[model samples]
Target: MAIHRKRFRVEEAIVGEMPSPEMIEEAAPMHSEIMAELRAIRAQMAKGTPPAPLSGSAAMAAIDASTAHELSEARTMLETYRAQIEQCEKLKVELDLIHDAIDRTKREIATLHGKSFDGGEMAKVNGELGAVVGGTEQATQQILEAAESIDQAASAMSKVQSADQQKRLADDIQERVISIFEACNFQDLTGQRISKVMGTMKFIEQHINAMMEIWGGVDAIKAHVPAHVDTRSEDDKLLNGPKLAGDVGHASQDDIDALFD
Candidate 1:
């Protein structure tokens, strides 16, 4: 085998020495660029490598965070459902109370109708009132007629000179007075008829008060009350009947006499 050897010149020999501070400063930019390119090559190599699995504590922390979030959402939904249930319960209770009230009102109305109209109580009351009016009118006419007859007999007695004629006139006046007394007996019948009418009216009033109580008291229901409408004609409105005992705001016989005076 042939032996070959390469010879190096002394001027081309390599040397080793510390770099100057100015040279280091001038190479700073190149050093940074080289370092950045080396980091980029490392990142490309790491992309193909599988990442290390999480440690025990890190994995547990991630799982706990997810569980806490889910639990919080579940609690919020449960709270909303609980509130809805409470609202539904309140509405059900209110509806039940209203239904019971309606049922009671229906029963009361049926009872009132059955007793007042269907049972003929209203008709009986009307008939009784009519009888009272008729009896009062007949008695008044009879009394007036007797009074006129007595007045005529008294006037005749004053004019008569004979004792027999005067005695006859006095007897006729006595007879008329007795007739007036008998006509006054109609007051007893009027009282009985009025009592019957009063009883019927009282029954109706009791039922009406009960109906009013079903909704609320008179004061509670006052706002719902409709305005009253007068249906009477002007002449009918002026036709007030005789005042009862203890009635005020009406003119008596004494007041009329005073006016005349």
Candidate 2:
């Protein structure tokens, strides 16, 4: 037995230690005091009782309220700024449309004036004329939309009932009209053609001015006219006379003789 005996060692399991009574007693007062204060505050809030005022606390609260008000005002200002930007974007689109319409009209007029009697020249001119007319028609529709937008914006500005607003609107309209007039001046149409178009435009302008004077401006005239009235026929008649005469008179006599001979 002394020679063959084997010793077996048993290991004890370790257990977690609990906190001491003194430590628990020390922590208990701090926990209860915190809980009591929290309950008191909750009760006061529930009862709608105002908190005990502190020195400088009133000023701080007022400052917080003022900050909140300022923030609200800033938000409102940002919204207004966004709306203004949107309105400006819309106006820009309308302005571009008007410019495009004027360009198309000018191109069409140029094409019509450049037409020749030669078959090849006539064919080329006709194709150009067709394209010009198509562009003009599309541009005209866009211009009409832009005009409507202008009218609406003008009306809205007028309704502001402010002298500054009215003056601004008037100035804007005048500027736009002047720009249109300047654009309409035909630099390409020189010599007889330019003279004729200028004369025609002047005549039209005078007539329109006279009408405005007599009828108390465009609005009055438009109001007096029947809704179904077709004014384009009269306008076309006025436009065509000078244009036709100028074109005929400008024809080369030598070219005519060569064709006949």
lDDT scores of the candidates, listed in order: 0.84, 0.63
lDDT of 1: 0.84
lDDT of 2 by residue, 1-261 (tens): 124333233311232354445667779999999999999999989999896676698879989999999999999999999999999999999899778756665554454444433466546545555655565565556556556656766887857888888788777666655544443332332334435445545654655455454435688777877778646785564453433534753436576599989
Q: Residue-wise lDDT of candidate 1 within 72-96, one digit each (tens)?
A: 9999999999999999999999899
Best by lDDT: 1
Q: How much does each candidate deviate from the true structure in C-alpha RMSD?
A: 12.3, 34.4
What TM-score fits each model? 0.67, 0.26
Worst 10 residues of 1 by lDDT: 2-11
Residue 52 in model 2: lDDT: 65
Give the least accurate 10-residue stretch of model 2, judged by summed lDDT: 4-13
